[model samples]
Target chain A: MKKQLQSLKRIGFTVGMTAALAASSLAQAEDKLKVGLMLPATGTFAALGTAITNGFKQYVAESGGKLGGREIEYFVVDDESDPAKATENANKLVKRDHVDVLVGTVHSGVALAMAKVAKESNTLFIVPNAGADELTGPLCSPNIFRTSFTNWQPGYAMGQVAAAKKAKNVVTLTWKYAAGLQSVDGFKEAFEKAGGKVVKEMTLPFPNVEFQAYLTEIASIKPDAVYVFFAGAGATKFVKDYVAAGLNKTIPLYAPGFLTDGTLEAMGDAGQGLLTTLHYADGIKNAKNDAFRLNYAKTYKSQPDVYAVQGYDAAQLLAAGLKAVNGDFSKRAEMVKAMEAAKIDSPRGAFTLSKAHNPVQDFYLRKSEGRDNKVLEISAKALADPARGCKM
Target chain B: MDFYSFLIQVLNSVQYGLLLFLVASGLTLVFGIMGIINLAHGAFYMVGAYMAFALSSLTGNLFTAILLGIPLSLVFGAFLEWALFSHLYKRDHLEQVLLTYGLILIFEELRSLLVDDEVHGVAIPDVFSASIALNDTLSYPVYRLVISAVCIVLAIGLYFLIQRTRLGMMIRAGSHDRDMVQSLGININLIYRTVFALGVTLAAFAGMLAAPISSVFPGMGGGVLIISFVIVVIGGIGSVWGALFAALLVGFADTFGKVLLPDFAGAIVYVLMAAVLLWRPEGIFKKG
Candidate 1:
């Protein structure tokens, strides 16, 4: 009887300890916010990914590594800018890591895959860089949001700039792909409406840098201006080749900011005076932008571009939502409502989200000067995506 | 298109074709004489382009960069052969493919570590930077013409070296019967090593010459590699002459296809490859 009583006392002690541990762990879980970052850590888009990650972390750091009284825990996965692996990589973060929110991706194709997974799982997702229109148009969810402009935004703004320049006949060139085609479509929609003609729409296979044939044809067509959509290494090569072929001297080149952003340094004198449109530029003289740029350069040893701006705004949007709920994820409806209504004071300037969850922001006319896309003027004010296929 | 535009397109085709030849010739020579399918040949081209970018930045002249880069590439090629590829010779094709493919990954990773993945421009030598005006708006960069001239010169020199020299005789003989050449007291291994290094040097030199126009970037080799393989296969694998012919044919097809059928341009070269394969299973030339 004495031994039996001792065994019961031991069992009671174990039960009490287990209850205490469980209660503490539950409290800890509620106090932490899990953020999954699925970005390209390798391949062509790696540098852009790094800049975005830096910008996100920079904001969190400024807030003392906490958002809305909750400590932030980050899980990172490199999507490799490959769409084939994007679903699996996102699932690793969502299903396995059980992250509360997902932030990602520069490549449009990979972004689409991540959006599908996020939609299916009903996880909160914020796109920082990819400008795929479908993300906000057809595939948008109440849980999904974008801090960056749609692919159409900058392209449409540039078309207005080109038409205002009185370019009667314009040629559009890009690699044949969804991003390229959509950008061209955006350019056509705005330019043609403004009484300009797209004389030719030329495209090569995706990732093909050989532009001699196309350039030769462009010269023959003799359009008043040439608008192109190319980014990264392809952009640098095109700018240099365009200058080398003497087309830049006779026929001016117009493009969205992607043609000049992150590519000006490699373009040398070839990129001088090249005009493009974007949501952010180096010469935006606002106090918030100044502080953000100063802090980003000091912390990362690189100047923040539009991509970094988008990432920073993504964090700001999330912080606003989290602040509304005091880190209570169970109050998700109220939190999401707070996010939709919040005006993000971004480095690009103050912007609000459209009904489709895409940023309604200003697009700036920027010129490539040395290593900077110096802001010339505001090209468009508070531009919003049409969200053509969005039902919600 | 008008006559002048067509004339310019022809010039573009030829220039592109000649550049492709410089890269494809090396592939053919390595395969013909060594019986080794070098998947990493394109990586050597990338190395050359990067060297041009680095050396030109240091020296401030692309001509000087190429002058310095050639010997460095020769040494690199020789060292790589002696260290890793020499062992690969006795292995089967699968083993060779695996090893060379691994080399490509290693080279790309090393490039990323050494020089971050950013596009870099190599300035054309000042003398070759000017454009030759063909019409009011159409002008051709002189650097491209210079590239065609240099490639033609190299091709002639390569022909003389392989067809007219004693070393060339030993190389051709060794390719045919390695054991017989060894029995005849010739250092067949040395011949193979020299041939391999020469092939590497040619590819690297082409890369250096093209860098000013192409702009050096990562994965640049991947595109060139596929085309080089096509050239080698279409040119009858081992024949340098055949590679030259195939490269030009592909260049014309690609250039014109882009002009005529913009939507189908990417498929045109592969279609040409298929047609050629159907016509001549051994390629345009028999294995030498």
Candidate 2:
């Protein structure tokens, strides 16, 4: 009878332990927050995507690997910078993985598609890099927020700078794409407002780097200055070609910051003394920026660029919302309200969201100097996107 | 545009055309002689550009980089032909396409692994870096002129190699009847290998020449490949002279089209291709 009682006790202990373990795991699952990161991991934008991921994870890791006392679980999907696969890729994270919040994307077209998916599912989405105007304009929603500027902001700011410099008749050149077109429109809006006339606008097909024919045309037009919108390898080639063609000697070239940002190193001496406007520069002096830059360099072994800053700010915005709602995503409306209203202390500096949920930030005029985009001045202070078509 | 500016535009078109010819001549030769469709021809161009970037940095001179890169690419071409392309010659067009297409991906991935995805600029030699002032506002880079000159010399060399030499006769006969040339005990396989190597060398050499001006970057090959194919198609599949003519025509159309019809500039090349096909379905020249 004693041996049988001992055996029964052992069985009871085992059952009790099993029940407790299951209960704890269930609670942990409920408490943890799921975040899906859909960004390009391959193709042209791959490096940008990796930097963004590092910045996001760096913020999370700084908060002891949790946000607002909730453990963060991450799911990643490579959108491949292909807009055609954007819907499918986003769905894999939202409907399939059932993530609570979605963060993505560098390519504007892919980001727009991801925004569509996020809206249909009523999931919270934060755009880290893409600057598509429609995201904040026609498609604005309470659950949608962007940590980056519109494609219009930097261009418009540069236009003001160019006008102040007394460039009376300017010519513009860019690849014929939505981003390029919108950027030129923004420049035109501000320049024309400042009594500056655009003499000519020339464009080639997208991803075509052959600019000799166009350079020849620009030479003949002889505008006071030339403005262009090109990024990555195209930007590098254009700057080199422009200098090589001796156009830079005769015509002052201007652009939004993308012309010199990640491409300055490859551009070598060709990009020297070139001026551009953007939301971030390498020499912003503040305790916040200083500390952020130091910590990022320590963690990643590389200096954080505009993309990394945007990614960090996305996490910061999410953290603000999570903190307000006490880590309960069921209180999503309250969380989103907190996100919209939060004044994020970004590495780019402090910025607040506009009514359309785009960043209302300062745009800086930067000069390319020795592989650095050195800050010249604040070109536009507290610049807000018009968000022309938004009802929200 | 004034006459001087028009002259500048013509000069630009010819220079651009010559560069395209350097790449397309190889594509035509490979197709015409080897009977193998090399989709990775552009990738070879990219490889050459990257080689220019890598070797120039090491040797500290673009000229030396080209000098070293030629023999290396020749050996690479021969090895590729011996190991992979030789097997594909006996296979169907679909299989050849599949293999060469796979090669493009492999080459791109290898490039990424070796060089990373950052754009790199190869410094132009000091001797050729200056620009000749065309007028008060416009000047053309002397490097571009050097490029045209080199391409012209290579074109002459290629012509002589194919038209004058005993090897050229053998190559011509082989293209006409491969079995007959083999029965003549000419070691037709060795000839094919030499021809393939020469084609690769030309394409790579074009890439090297373009590197300083173009700014080496990922996917640089893709654009050039499509245009090269158009040149190949328009010039007729196996005709080098036809390729030269077609490339020049394309260059003029593209340059003029950009000036006159900016909105339709992108479609102009394809439009030219469509017009050519309608006029001569097999292209501008008959097969060799």
Per-prediction DockQ: 0.66, 0.67
Model 1, runs deviating above 4 Å: A1-30
Interface root mean square deviation per prediction: 1.1, 0.9
Fnat of candidate 2? 0.77
lDDT of 2 by residue, B58-109 (tens): 9999999999999999999999999998887778999999998998899989
Chain B TM-score of predicted candidate 2 relative to the true chain B: 0.98
Candidate 2, residue B128: how far the Cα is off, in Å: 0.3
lDDT of each: 0.91, 0.92
In lDDT terms, how accurate is model 1? Answer: 0.91
As for candidate 2, its clashing pairs are none
Backbone collision count in every prediction? 0, 0
Residue B282 error, candidate 2, Å: 1.4
Which tens-of-lDDT digit does each residue in B212-251 have in candidate 1? 8788888888889999999999989778788888999999
Of the true interface contacts, what fraction does each candidate have? Answer: 0.74, 0.77
- Residue B221 CA displacement from its true place in model 1, Å: 1.3
